[model samples]
Target: MKYIFATFLLLNTFHLFGQESAPINHELSFQFDNDLLFFDAGDRYYTNGLFFTYRQKIKEDRSWSNLFGFQSLHKSIFHVAFVSKIFNPYNLKGEKAEEIDRPYAGELYVDGLYTSYWGQNRLAVGVDLGWLGTKTRSDDIQTNLHTTFGWVRPRGWRDYQIHDTPIAHLYTGLSREIVSIGPLSLISDVDVRVGTINTNAAAAITMRLGRSQPLDASVLTHARTGERIANDRKCKELFFVTKTQLMHVFYDATIEGNIIGEPSPFVKSAEPWVWMQSVGVMLSMKTFDLQALWSFLGREVVGGRPHKYGTLVIAKRF
Candidate 1:
């Protein structure tokens, strides 16, 4: 498994390293992808996931656009991040106790934006909504877990390895370009979400290195605090990208990752914090765009044996 993951990363890195100069603009785009991963058996299984995305602008202010996407994770095994020993069996029913497989589920969402309404200063808002294809098992497992972690858990919910449950979300956030100091341009992506039968807020900033082949870096912070519709927690995300164009050859590479709070029953015990990371490169020629991405997701650490996952994704847009 380790070798396979290493090889996938190397292959994707080489593929993306070759394509560094690509320009993004106003146009309608559609993308579809399938991703697969294998975990140890007797306690684990593999996942076959699929995704589809569409994005376009309502008009051409070069400032307004919208995105709609769907993602499905089928035949996948979820990890158990926490352990509960003192909870009531009735309360623990249908909770995150061990790893389990879900056949398939769909996620649908849409986001819209309106930038620079008046002049130099700009603003944008976004929203997302979707449902997991299945629902939790209504049994003793759920009740038992809930009783044990009712206080320590971020949300008043137990960690559960759930399947076929609905997953829906909504987000509204804004951003502004505050400074342009020489070769550096600073921008922000901030938003608030009210869904999951709760509410949460998140924000991130981007600092562009104008002279360095249009490279840019960013950091994001998200939290769920108070009783206003979200939970109470905090996390950080980092991102960086660079692109170079030499006549007909163009290449670009981007890396992004996040340290997020894990509230799900599956990962309740391993640690309240988890990490998700991805790196990608794209090469373009005229109207053709070719790209490859390597991603790592799941708990940041697991006892003496850390659990890590990786994927190689290829995509094209025109």
Candidate 2:
């Protein structure tokens, strides 16, 4: 952890001192998802969680121009995130609770990405390094469990846990706008990941409605541009967005079924695939953006119930 911090600081220093033309952007955001808000019918796949992220972007030209000074050579992004996850109601109460609950876990990770663009299409490669373990307090876990299940007995110190391990994941993604009709646009994206502990692939299609014009080329390709520089667009805009995705999981090292000596014995076998659909609205202005999305997920595990979750994101850019 100390080394990671040191590296981050060093990189930031290089960014700050390198060149005058280099531009940087940063965003702070929070996201939360819970099953209780789904109105009691939804359950498995994922339960409830909170995630906080800090992201920094450096423009490609500037990065490449300052490469001799330890600057990046491609459009680069760095992210730091904190995550917390809580178990579902059924996992908290059944006779097999101790073996299946998983209770809760806390994780912290740092991610780095390098991206390149061709017209409106983008290609990105990234890696995530983190630590995941059963560090969340049992009392807090019980409180959330009670909130979701109501009047459930606390499980005491008996809980399931994944053995602490450093996580390393590498991935690549491609995204592009496929079509446009007036103020509406269609976009597609696909991503694949392989890690020391997990492997998954996903593809998604999305539609955006109500923009006066298509997103700027830089924004479309997630690159830095004069629009981000001038920062003159204080006028707010509203849009409705919808997305559908298909995902497949080949393995998960954190789940008990895939790792030896894992204390959380919830799943005896891995579920290979899942599907998700979401609808949302986005509001964006000069320096602020907010989005609210409702999502439905298909069954991820055999006999597991399909579920619904909501995500709210608020971001401030600088």
Candidate 3:
């Protein structure tokens, strides 16, 4: 319901920035991303996604985080993360001068945080050992983006989830500390994917709207059922986004959906529902976040076919 007034004012505004009265401090940072105008639904692509995050708090509860990621396409990273799914089961073919190593999708996490005696908000429990090369990687950005629905990919990059079976996974997450206005801060998180889709679910709502207020908004939603595409089981998505950080630097727009039954080839059982839209902009730099997007699909309720487009993403996160 419109995120219930920004998730109840971001849970009482995280009790005022999850305060600790200022004292325990330690910092580390690293981020790099470059999609350079990429699109998956229509399959017009370009990707260079590299994410590395490491954080250690060791005292205020406990924390350990490590995530090293890589993806490459006309700019290869094993043909953009190598895929087939469930994890992987040998499916790598090469071309364009060879060196196609088959599998690797990094992920490692250890966590424990409960800082709310008035620290504001904190409650976490984690564990996720990973590998699932791309083919949508089940569509990331935290898997739940609502505008209509989710899951879209036409060819190479939609590889059954890294090639169908390579397991060693575990996940659990719950984070809440919603509400911070005036530089804008609102966060909500939920994750439970455990041992690979028994009842997968993910949710996130974040609004940090302020770098001098150009405008920022985020919404992600996800649900699961086997991973679809053969009888088209079940999948859900909604990613309504709004970004404009101080006159450009990065601008965005999104609305996507896909639901099916009568053997969806892109939904046309008389059309269950398929919608897409993307806008663009990126030119300054808070940390260089570029942008570009144009996508297609509509068949009743909004109509369709305008060029069947694609292109969006140009990243740099320092």
Who wins the TM-score comparison?
2
Q: Would you list the C-alpha lDDT of every candidate in the order shown?
A: 0.28, 0.58, 0.27
Q: Candidate 3 lDDT (Cα, whole model)?
A: 0.27
Q: On residues 94-152, what C-alpha lDDT tens digit does candidate 1 reach at each position?
A: 23333222111122334333322222222334444433312222223333433575522
Candidates 1 and 3 compared: the better one by lDDT is 1
For all predicted structures, in order, the TM-scores are 0.38, 0.73, 0.22
lDDT of 3 by residue, 180-233 (tens): 555555556565544431224445554433332111111111101101122221
Q: Can you write out model 2's per-residue Cα lDDT over 194-306, one digit (the tens) per residue?
A: 98656999999988887522333232333432224333444345678889999998876544333433445444344588889999887665445567788998765555556
Residue 37 CA displacement from its true place in model 1, Å:
7.7
Ranking by TM-score: 2, 1, 3
Off by over 4 Å in 3: 1-93, 96-168, 188-205, 208-318
Q: Which model, 2 or 3, shows the larger lDDT?
A: 2
- Candidate 1: segments with Cα more than 4 A from true spot: 1-49, 60-124, 135-166, 173-192, 197-272, 297-318
Error of 3 at 121 (Å): 6.2
